[model samples]
Target: MSGEKLSLKDLARKRDLLAPGHRLCAGCGAAIVARLVMKATRGPTIVACATGCLEVATTIFPYTAWRVPWIHSAFENVASTASGIEAGLKALKRAGKLKYDHVDVIAFGGDGATYDIGFQAISGAFERGHDILYVLYDNEAYMNTGIQRSGGTPKYASTTTSPAGKVIPGKLELKKPISHIMVAHRIPYVATASPAYPLDLMRKVRRGLEVEGPAFIHILAPCPRGWRFDPRYTIEMARLAVQTCVFPLWEAENGKYKLTGVSRSIARNPKMKKPVEEYLKRQGRFRHLFTPENRHLVDEIQKIVDEEWNWLLKMCQLS
Candidate 1:
């Protein structure tokens, strides 16, 4: 996994680490993200998954979708469990009981697990500098648990817990800045990715595994059922998220930031980016924000997007 871009042919030849026939929802972005991440691997890897859609759908009573070794840990301990596995492997190798020179340990969690319930464990793992990669499939709300609102839910987006109402619109608070939070840990690698851009996502996963210390990749996985979008438009919504500067694709390595994928151009010329309204209109969760009385909320969301985009550009030294 050098800096060189992998050809589609080369990527196609790789074994499908996540086999088909799973119960994941059709057009589920998390499933796509998992497949691409596993396909990018160059060697054997172990996966630790939090109790989320991925885990439930992939590992039903008597079947599984994973081709490689995988562990389904509790919702709040995916990172810590992966860290322990990494430690055990290190000990085994040191005792000359293991022959392999390297084996990647990756943990996967949804927004509820990563941003709320599992935050402490994930933070501890990063703080301890464990040799593991943690990937957060941020579908905004808790899609698997009746579409409850989580910390990752964007402002004005409707959810089960934060439903739109007369007095209080949708979610009143903004989405958590998890990417910057991870950057604050000063880990070896921290990246933002989307399933719309498979190559970029794969590249980030590959880079994250290549690093020695703890690494993190936050992926914006759109939910068709929760977001109220067409199943076929999952990738389109993911692309719009990046094109509108609502979710930028970038990475921070050793505390230095650099834009990747379509975000590079958006970082250079903000005018090239699409309007946040375009992205909002495509999703039903934010449909309430389009009203004349609530139109100001759209402007507010746009303002926040601009502020965050500018902040990212400044951090990347592009502004």
Candidate 2:
């Protein structure tokens, strides 16, 4: 597969769509994800963001951080809202009332919205073939609502609702395979990315836009407060997730899969893969997994990660 075509030089020339003043935490990976995505877009664009950290932090009252046309949708209807927007644009174009030659319609939602609350909406939109790109900045938990557990949170990761106390060692269920779910939708494009790989992520964003039908990109966005990590390790957490094979970066175009970035390299050489512990130890949410009694849990988690990574590789191989 061809590597990420967009270079740092090309990206450096693009103006930042997201402004500097926002209420997101210091060293927030979601912010980086949004910025890189904005850089990838060149023409007229309209953004529809679900009610989450990005929406709340960036558009507080009269003040706004978004330089492009933006809309704020409810937690469970961003996809529906974007679908309506796309439909409206089509209608206007058919009537010869719209001025723009082309417009990119994108939706931004966090894990709570995308993986759970908004799943049905997204599924419907994709099935209806909306010309929109849906991006999920998965911080693993509902960080905007006091670090609550969500479908996107990995197993054994502690959250306020699923605390790592004496009886419970964090959440028991595995994280939902959302990217795979999107792929199953049979959309024109589906991808998994991380803010750590800006070139890879930006490339996927651009590719998703190029596709005619609905597209989805699931991005790992580390949260310092929610994940219990230092502010400086935001990007490190994103990188470690890919290196550990806990989150493999890949893209599926027209139902054909191909690994990308470090994940592609690691797929070629298994020796390049790091242990899942490297990723777990960095986050406070998984601190309990390192305990004497819970040590076996780490091995178990490693097994699952390995299995998932191999499954992804097989999909690409078969493709």
Candidate 3:
């Protein structure tokens, strides 16, 4: 995929490893992410998906959209399960009992499973240096379970667990810095991707998979029902996320960091970056922030975004 230009016609002609007919939402960014991710596999790939929208929808009853070997893992143990698979495959290959020469192992989990419930397991796998790539399709909440606020949820974004009202704002906490945490591990690769840029996302996936050691990609996926946006606006929302610096597109390879895609331009010229409100205004979850009384909350959130972006730029410059 190095020089291959990704277009609708070209992608349609390629064999999608995730296949079509999955029951994911019409504009679910996770589905698009999963499809593009699988297209970057270098060899026979095995996927271990945590119990979430991707696992539940893609594997209903006996029917499955996965055209490759797949495992349905419990929500909090996807990393552990993927680590076991990788270990088993290596053991078999060492004993000369396995037919396949190589198999790329990947673990899939939502934000709830990744940033919260499965955090410890993922940390263990990364520390152990397992040969696996963990793809986190973060829609910023536990959307599969009634849209409850997870650690990945942004501040003031209303969810079932954190409803905004005259009495209280939505979630009070900022999003967990999962990417930075993973980068601190000094892994082979750690990237933040968005479905808005398919080529960038696919290239990162390929890089993550091709790397020798543990790798992780945190993908910003948009959910139509959870975010209260039109189905057609999923890609638009993703693109705005980068342009607004609400979710920057970048990667850290072996403790070295660099901004990728449009984020690089935003770093050089701050004027090119759009206001964070441009991203927040698109989703109904952040609608209350537009109110006269709640307007200050938007400013507060913007301050955090600005600071985070500045910190990220400084971090990249250090390398």
Candidate 4:
């Protein structure tokens, strides 16, 4: 093994791999996620970004926040574009025409691209067994364009399209379990991480990079303006997400599940999980969830989360 100790903090520096003069809004989670991810990955790592907030905000005209070779693709073509790059890299490596043998390919996309628009392309890459790392920095909604509901949007989280009203209280359906869907792919590695959990997130990123086949890391990123929360509370909101069981940090490799980031009291905490209302109450998006019927709906969602957690505990042997 190399002499490098495994420390995400040691690995990540705040000295602007993405740079300090970027155009991201205050407390932009995508920008933070991008920086952390780039910091974790060493060598000639190339990034392919879709047409989203990060792409537009970072790269305007001749300027860019990225220090590595980065490409801007269409909204739904990041995965496909990354696949092509991977293929070319392989061919070049095979022909002894490539400069670096440690080149890692990464594709970054928002929730809309990963969960809805670019999903097929992502699925195709995985099925084809492309050797690349696809990171979905999920802010839960189509944040690039006004806050609209996407497949990753949690139940009752208000968006512009799924606005709360007298009868309709934001989104009525459950959040799409994209990490579970990646597990269904039976790929080499699959993990769910959050920006708040930077060390854990970087650990998983390193593991995924070491894997031979396709890998997926879904990062739960918080959007301040989109979620109607104060920009300063982004980290707190993310921490609460895992604490409340709204988001679980777990991994599935070679069909075996492993749950991480469990609180001290497993049984008691699972049964007495923090109310979804608490999470919703932080953001104005879910203000309606505080109402009687909507509060009940939020409870129902919590129950579903409990059931899933219990099942995962058995499948993954969580304490």
Candidate 5:
């Protein structure tokens, strides 16, 4: 809650609320993100997951990978459902009918659900000031539904819907600034995290849970299958995303922003930022952008990344 660093043993000692034996793809970043989030909580937690890769894979039929109480809600209503659950719990506590004094409620959704179809519900929950943590396991595209382009998909990344060809190169639209959107709601906590940095992610998760009102974490989860990369490069790709400033790790609390992890260092020294190409070249989804004809698209993507990084630094008052 205080941004205290957790030792490896400390993290290891925490119970794995999200158990193993699920059907997530090999090296799936969403699973890693969920596990880390579950490990960071201090007490009983109820998780509401939207219909996506995480929900479908973890709660298949009778078997479930979740060790804690979990609910599988509709794609566009995870936040709303979690809000209802929070309201119900509060009502029970008010009537002295609840056994537990404290319980953390969390909602898990993919980019398609959080950044696209579910945006309205998410925004409404934040506006209503629900005591819940909404985490977006953003693998960019809608990986669960055949790798379609979603609002979170980065520009110039090819997806099943946004195919690279003679016409449009890739997803021409820029990635939706979901974290900023959440910050605009003036919530207690808003953060962008990557599974590559588990400690930082855990710290943010802990901080979010400690807050009194709504909290949102946007995680840049890399998809090895959809990204067309080797399963082993999931963490590496996530690291590259942060190092390249493509996905800056930062948190906004009550409108005040602070860069974290490698992004904090990069904020102090912009020269330390890695090229966006380093992050893109590894993923096959952006492979076509490297072609001679499509080289401009890569430059365009770089420009957007730089603008966003600079703006983030400005928001944090780092520059």
Candidate 6:
């Protein structure tokens, strides 16, 4: 697809909607995801941002990073706030007072907000069929609050709340299947994406926005500080996540599953294996995963991921 129109590089060139001079960390995958999301949005888009790294980083004092119309709402209310915005826009359109022909509303929140505190509001928006896109940049914990464990934290991952102990290893429960829950809601569109694959992410973002009802794009953002990995390895870690089947790239439109991108070579070929250790060893969160008892936990994780991949691929085929 290199020389063809709408190539990956061409889509990647869609840039600078969120300008330079923003205060995100050097390897903040959330920043990359937000940039691509903004690029793919059609019509006049307004954003409702929740309290998190992105909000504090961008809207520091008089300095604002977003070029689009954006509002800062309470962390748990971003989805509700975006719904309000959509309603206002619809009211204006009906009254012939709206300046734009089509107005798109988006809500930005972290995993803490989406998977924990804000889940009910998000579900309400989905159930009510709001015309908006809610993007959850899943760094997998409450990074803004001292790396505390949130509902999205993976099984056996360490966090401030669920720290490694002689008795307790770390977060013990499996990461909540946020996307699958949304899919159960039967929203018109739902997707899992990553900043490492910008083209794929952008394509999914565009598709989500075009859907008539509520849509969601859950992005797996790797946090250098939270994960205890070198900032430079952010993109590499994200790519490995997909290659190892730890995070799959796929979408659902009108309840039809579609696996948009897959590292099939990694799945089919033996040489492509990168030990789950490689992905985990870099992260302090999984420090306990190296323990003898927890060593098998890593294998279990791999097994779960592989099984999910197989099931999802079959679902895609059936779709």
lDDT of each: 0.93, 0.93, 0.92, 0.83, 0.92, 0.84
lDDT of 3 by residue, 188-224 (tens): 8999999999888988888898888899999999999
Cα lDDT tens digits for candidate 4, 1-319: 2213457466744345677688988998888888878777856788999888999999998888888889987999899999999999999999999989768899999999999999999999999999899999999999989999999998878899999988888888888889889878888989888888887787788778888888999988899989999999988888788777778788888768877655324544566467656787899987877777666876787788778777777877632
Q: Tens digit of lDDT per residue, candidate 5, span 109-197? A: 99999989999999999999999999999999989989999999888889999998789888889888999999999999999999999
Error of 2 at 3 (Å): 10
For candidate 2, write residues 185-227 as lDDT tens digits: 9999999999998889998999998889899999999999999
Q: Which pairs clash in model 2? A: none
TM-score (C-alpha, index-matched) for candidate 3:
0.97
As a TM-score, model 1 comes out at 0.98
Quote each prediction's TM-score: 0.98, 0.98, 0.97, 0.93, 0.98, 0.93
Question: Which residue window of length 10 is worst by lDDT in model 2?
Answer: 1-10
Q: What is the lDDT of candidate 5?
A: 0.92
How many clashes does the backbone of model 4 have?
A: 0
Is 1 or 4 the stronger prediction by lDDT?
1
Candidate 6 per-residue lDDT, tens place, 1-319, comes to 1111235655556556687799999998888778878878766789999999889898898989888889997989999999899999999999999988998898999999999999999999999999999999999988888899999998888888989888888888888989989999999999999788887887788877788889999999999988878889899889888767688888888888876665545545636656566788778888887878778888888887767777877877787
Give me the runs in candidate 3 sitting further than 4 Å from their true place: 1-12
Clashing pairs in 4: none
Deviation from native of the Cα of residue 267 in model 1, angstroms:
2.2
- Report how far off residue 205 is in candidate 1 (Å): 0.6
